[model samples]
Target: MTRRPIFNRRRFLGTAALGGAALASPAYLRRAYAQSGGEVNIWTYNNFVPEDFQKQFQDETGIKVNVRLVDDQGKQFNLLAAEQPNPTVDIMTVAGHRFLQFVDSDLLAPLDTDRLTNWGNINPTFSESDWATVRGNKWGAPILSGMEVLSYNTDYVSAEEAQTWDTLFSEQYSGQTAYIIQDMMSIVMLMMGYDGNMVEYLDDPDTAARIVEEAKQFLIEKKPLVRKYYDSGAEVQQMFVNQDIVLGHSWNGPAAALITDGFPLGMAIPQEGSYGFVYTFNIANNAPNMDNAYTFIDAVLASPEIGAAMTRASGFISTYKDASQHLNDLERKATSFPDEQLANLQFFRAEANELKYGLVDPAVEAIKAA
Candidate 1:
């Protein structure tokens, strides 16, 4: 098997496509079940687990894992919700922003911290977010985090010019800057915060709304400068690679790939900070293999090999505290855990009803039209 770089444009797909596929790495397929002698099923998206993660976990715990990849969280959540009486999946990973809706609907089971030996091993800062907790009970554990950063093509923009967000809207780069069309709230959050405290906007709906409006207006003002709006990380990477764009607001995975490939690319959190979207693992209320589920979670968290592999391949910072020791300098810099980002990490959370009722979609459409 050719070892692919951890994450690349070729692998980035839309959320809808990401959520429904069954992708098993060779290591996973060859491993035998150790303890339960039963199968454990996990449903998650791209980068949630390194390609080799399932294999490493099975080798350590003797648990056979069956992984199904889904592209869209909303679709996957609905599918799991429909399967509530008897879920086909034992554990599902959902984005942090959407976890409350799952909890309010009772689609997820409250995590039994007592059953998780590694529960204490997780840094409380990442695992203890109100967004990951429901009804004052912990329902999820952060597994991976991705942030929006300014990524630019060095072949085009000067190093100094690319260091700020202005590179994305500057006239010199007209029709050569790109941003994700779907990240309205994140874009707004970034514009509103100076160097962190992006989380504060989550507490003030009025402030968030005002920020959104300002950001929308900003985008509309720059519409002439945008080459094209993109919908997935892969798409942005493609545009950058093709030289259709000089700068963009993009995620770490794509930026890492470009840098590793020797593209004249640079990424920074910028002085104003960035927005983060985290994905977390949650148990289902109707989990058929609860013991296997807990074992699976613990096994993955316990495997330094798996954690290191994830960092190397996926560009996602593993949530387990112990995983840090296995990481190299680059890996350490990638996650928000210990140093540079510890003070700035922001999680997405809100009540289920609030999210369901929020008409942010229309607001985004209004921005595009305006």
Candidate 2:
């Protein structure tokens, strides 16, 4: 069944531009056009919501969603920080680590659960003090959540054999595994066990550095086996599908993609434990269209039709508990919305500025040098 395209920002913008009267004074017309309870500006990373869901949202709410794409969380945060009281968009989707930073700077508004009717449907995993809570209030609600798992090619090895990080460094799978270019911390956490506790490594800078050295040493020793580290999930998936990789680190989304495509791939949380992050949707403090913004969010979470479409397209666990009943068996199993798995998973904590960036890059570079 082919899905029909519903009205969206581009289509709406094109129509508005074509309306000769509206284009006469671009800035004034723009402001005037946005003043209506018909437009909601959203800032987020690409592919968070499926195109079909965007259309569904527009169709259901009569609110046109204008999404501004940013490449990374840092860039998005920087942009939002610069536009404090008067911002461009009404909402921002930030990852777990970056959300804390935004909260600390007062760049975000207190999330109003009173307006969010689906607030009760939120998974208990997100209710933790360490995850999204700031001063006893939930600042953001998770849209997509996935744990970092060991992704392996089932064709190359049995799932039992590919169960541990130690297997990646084993001689058998040498030259067939890949790692993420930017996930130095997780790699280090898995390698040294952070002196027996992963969170401890993240907390103490000196201890983290020493652990990074240990992780680097492990990686350098296994360099011959690594095909190449990848920056994007698509790249990693391509490599795995082409049979160029036998083992690597990945999240549930990519693994699910491979499985859905009939590839011989599987993902595991590992015996050492697994960590994951969530992307939360926040209303931008200075958004021009507040009513439309609320309408859009409400539609996203409350409307089962839109939520189902979003889950199918984005491969993310729907935040709405009941909406997930619409997902197929495979999707339901892979989704993070299920409290059983999400509750058991370990979440990364927010800390000082240095803890965020300082310990990661240097560790990877040093390992590459050695």
Candidate 3:
């Protein structure tokens, strides 16, 4: 959280229902999508929507908000692909790194930004990136932005040893370390002193493939040091609860949640830098309720009123430029980071093709089996 808290950098602001359009404004977007009170089906991660937003949206627009919760990004991607012939959901939540696969497969619709008056409220880092836009058309509306970090039981590991990732492989912590598969692919590259996006090498297939292969072999060799290749945040937290892991690589949200609830834990952005992710809204291909999709996205972008509430529920920060204005000092600290560290925050890159991404799962699986 801000590399460390800077109490004076931000102040607490009361969340008194400023409910307006995006930019946390005193305005509203057109409500044409509410005609006949249609439904907008959304497939999203758990705890992503603020309760009040859901209640207020239905009350004000008469449109029914149907949410289908999804637990994993990979599974969500496959479900979308399988249903492509007759897509069921109107809008889906996706991570920046994974958006490309959806777009490449023709599973998403180009965003109708012209109708989204609040599209300008997005942070440039998200709105301008190649990941969020393609062929000069915006395809995703970024909602949450966060990065992964190395976390440890503060009572067992000193901050000094936790400053870098080498401790994760040290014999002293052997059989006490864990990491998510997808994350380690990029973070391990970071540990190798790669300050740029590792996937960017896909631009030169020869180099990218070689790099991936090397990383795969490296992970296989280190497999014995890892206690588990965790699949979810809850699983990692359970490891902490059972005293099964002394060190782990995890998303910032879960670790922050653990710390807030009085767990003896500490999360740090390692000195080698780390990868970041942004959760966003993408319209499904052939969505039946296209109008409703656009309207719902505007409401989400306009939801800085519950910025702090979202952080409490989901553990990630909003991408709205004025989000800091809504956060109290503590929330602000956990969401923002220092310039030096932020400079090295790399996001997963779009693969050269689906086959490129296809190689990733098996490589990770091979390490898991070994």
Top candidate, metric lDDT: 3
lDDT of 2 by residue, 1-370 (tens): 2322322434433432232221122121111122333778888654565565566456545677788875456667778888887888888887766666788878887788788765665666663537677777677767766667778866566677655667866888777888774564564565555532244546567876676656666677777877787766666766775557778887666676555444566777666666777878887765688767766665556544444545555545555556677666765665543444344356666654346456666766676666
- TM-scores for all predictions: 0.74, 0.76, 0.83
- Which candidate number has the best TM-score? 3
Q: Write the per-residue lDDT of candidate 1 for residues 1-370, one digit (tens) a residue.
A: 2322333444444322332222333243224335555778988765566645665666656777888977556568789878878889988987777766777778888888787766766667677865666667888767766777778766666667755676677788788888875563455446555212234445666765665566667767778888787766667767876667878888776676455444567776655456677777888888988898987876655544555555545556666667767655654554443345334444444542353225355556776776
Order of candidates by TM-score, top first?
3, 2, 1
Off by over 4 Å in 3: 1-36, 193-200, 203-206, 351-356
Clashes within 3 Å, all models in order: 11, 3, 0
lDDT of each: 0.64, 0.63, 0.73
lDDT of 3 by residue, 168-227 (tens): 878899999999976788777667754235445556767766776777898888888889
The lDDT of model 3 is 0.73
The pairs that clash in candidate 3 are none
Error of 3 at 365 (Å): 1.7
Q: Residue 247 in model 2: shift from native, Å?
A: 2.6
Question: Residue 64 CA error for candidate 3 (Å)?
Answer: 2.9
